[model samples]
Target: MAHPQPRTETSSDAALIRAWQAGDEQAAAELVARHARPLARFLAGAGAPDADVDDLVQETFIRAFRGVDRFRGHCQFRTWLLTIGGNVLKDFGRRAARRKVMPLDESVRDVTGDPHEHAEASEVEALLAAGLKQLPRLQREVFLLRAQQGLEYAEIAAALATTPGAARVHYHHAVRRLKEIVE
Candidate 1:
């Protein structure tokens, strides 16, 4: 018996979008699988709570699917998805502000270690989360996109609707501030 050949990943997001629009449910799944974890990490690093990350991710995908027809290939799909995730974060922040609730803690992970190491890591994570909260909105977005999501300045700028230079500045300032706090 002959073995079936494995499918290759699509070279471009436009192809995936076309597949999705053509009613291939697997295409949507592929897109989500490609982008979801990074988006969740971006949200968590931007001060969203661990409990709310999954809901926010679901909402992001729903919004993306609803508006996929509007997506032109001007930017990469990751950039576009980050833009959607940013908007969701902003909306949540606005609502939280209106309700007079504190924004969620930005730290969600506890890296495994010995007891002393665990304690030290926890303290550092808490401090880092506090420092992240102190950053301006744009700085936080830029920093998280670059640091957590590993997006380049161009991608960060596209996601945040800013110039690459501006994104670089925001990221620099964020790194400086975080270093001051962490070190």
Candidate 2:
């Protein structure tokens, strides 16, 4: 007989959102704890400055909770939260652009240990960052959602307000563009 699989916190994000909607404060905390890391990763991959990632995550959660009542469950809660994060990041970018103070060199974190490996990793990261920056907003968001967040095209479409077919096309275009840029 096969053993039953254990349930993970990831699978319960929707349940946590429901609990929070019902006025469960602990559930809100749990959702934040469960999603914070992934959201941070997504934000960083989308080119949020290292110094602003924590603030961006906080802002994303703030907006999500404030608009929680509007969440209609069309997508996963994490996807919805990330959609809010993308908007937050876009607004932040626009503000930074207006100030003519955009920063792109802050995404590479210092890695300890072997010097050669670190150099190679940093080079790849830089190339990817440059490539991502060149993509159109929809392609960038779709690529990050599908590639980095491991979301399905359907989930990405729901989050980005596009059709699944369009999401797939955007992701493919992003991949093709990145490959050309890298090569």
Candidate 3:
């Protein structure tokens, strides 16, 4: 008799995806656990109110699983996930706009060691957030994917469904505008 190998956390996302497709529910949960925080960060950077980030993240994963068959392996799974998340946020934004409810800027202020330093950092973050809101959708997405998530231009291109060159151009324009806004 042979013993079955235990599942390892080191499993690649592709393997997890395959297992999920095979109806292994644990695989889906694992994927969510692995990607949730990063996905939340991306959603929040894309202008999701802090309160809505969790719901948006859950919705993104739900949509991704529902449409898993449409995902080609052309990009990393995280990149694909982020793209779905962006769409989810956009849809939420539209609904929120229709309701005429303005989202509050409620980013948590770090109450840590140095009060003055924390205040300075929060001010910079606020300025950057304001600048991001002013950018066009594609430019904001490209900038957040690059500057916030550290995704390469090619991955960002795949996520945004644009050419890498176009992604780079958008990122450049975003950076230039942000400098003018934040500085």
By TM-score, the best candidate is: 3
lDDT of 2 at 158: 89
TM-score of every model? 0.82, 0.88, 0.91
lDDT of 3 by residue, 1-183 (tens): 965345799998888888888798999999999999999998887889887888999999999998888888888999899989989999999999999989886446325767788778778988998899899989998998899889999988876778999999999999999999999
Root-mean-square deviation (CA) per prediction: 4.4, 5.2, 2.4
lDDT of each: 0.81, 0.87, 0.88
Q: Best candidate per lDDT, number?
A: 3
TM-score of 3: 0.91
Q: What is candidate 3's CA lDDT for residue 123?
A: 85
List the candidate 1 regions with Cα displacement exceeding 4 Å: 1-7, 98-115
Candidate achieving higher TM-score, 1 or 2: 2
In model 3, what is the error at residue 139, expressed in angstroms?
0.7
lDDT, residue 168, model 1:
95
